[model samples]
Target: MYANTPRTTATRHRDRMSYDRDLVHSVLDEAWVCHLSFVVDGEPRVLPTLHVRIGDVLYVHGSTGSRPLRSAQPDGIKVSVAVTLLDGLVLARSQFHHSANYRSVVAHGTATVVTDPAEKSAVLTAIAEKIAVGRAADTRPPTPKELAQTSVLALPLVEVAAKMRTGGVSDDPEDYALPHWAGVLPLRVVAGDPEPDKGVEGVPDYLRAVIGVTG
Candidate 1:
């Protein structure tokens, strides 16, 4: 479990905050995109990009020319990254009590550009595999030229906390008697049928498993 420091402590909705490393990892791993917030010349900027977690480090990548990638230099850049997954929409008798069930993680740290060739390659592979379980092995590895054009930043999962809300709606006893529909509308990501290119043949086994297509 990660120890909560002043910066990591929850100031609001304290009951929803979690310091469990596994919880934090699950939330991060399940998310396809993460919002990265950082300052550039005293101005704030936020960019949404792909991310993958390998052990205790979170890796995000973009073109070498991207502003955020360029800013994370030798000394590293201070950043706040967030990942969230919405589970359901909570409907209450009263609008005031309405809320959504979600799992989220916010991390604060210095993000530094990954320079090692092997590590950079591995990270890129992990990001690809995150999209489809066994994709990295099926696709060609990035060439030296391709690797040079991409920039990856690594942020340690130190100052991180996961916040979540689950279960049914919570309404005042009086509000429950109101004449209105009240219940949770469950939400989840469902994988659609795989569409292959014109020249390609049958779906790969890995992809079939991902979308739950059985013979």
Candidate 2:
């Protein structure tokens, strides 16, 4: 267990919650997007964007002028970032027992805009690799102008929590006799055939490996 501060503790369904760093990183790594929440002008704002976890730090990027990106600073600007992956839908005998099988991680920390040139460039590369393993190497590197136009925020994985629920529906004991269907409708993210670019050549082995496994 680690980073289990009061801010990361759950008030309900505590049994489903965890303070484990491994669990947090697993959920974060599998997620494609994260919802970053922060206060802007006295209003709570949540923005869905690309995020990557390199070691214990989470990096999110955006247009330099965007409110969330611009407002982030080294000063204490409290923020929370969360990633959720739904595994299945639980269909219960009764409506009240409905639920979802999901894995989620919520992290609370201060948001700071990354300024160091080397670190900033590395983070951008990491973000690209997160999207696709071989993508960063396949594409041309960003220019100085491109880097200047973007802003990246680094959120430390200090106070974090992970929650998950799996398995079948839980209904009242008496409702078990009901003639309604009760089972889990499993879900997954699968990949289809690769869409090649104009006049592209052979499919990269790394990408082919991904599609082969997912397919």
Q: Give per-model TM-scores.
A: 0.94, 0.91
By lDDT, who's the top model here?
1
- What candidate 1 gets wrong by more than 4 Å, as runs, is 212-215
The deviation in Å at residue 146 for candidate 1 is 0.9
Model 1: worst 10 consecutive residues (lDDT sum) = 62-71
| Count of residue pairs whose backbone atoms collide, per candidate | 0, 0
Kindly provide the TM-score of model 1 when superposed on the true structure, using C-alpha atoms: 0.94
Q: How well is each residue in 1-215 modelled by candidate 1, as lDDT tens digits? A: 99898877778889999999999999999888899888877988788888899999999875535565675668898989999999999999999989999999999999998888788899989987887889888899999887876788899999999999999989999887899999999988877778998999899888877784211
Per-model C-alpha lDDT, please? 0.87, 0.81
- Candidate 1 — what's its lDDT? 0.87
**Which residue pairs clash within candidate 2?**
none
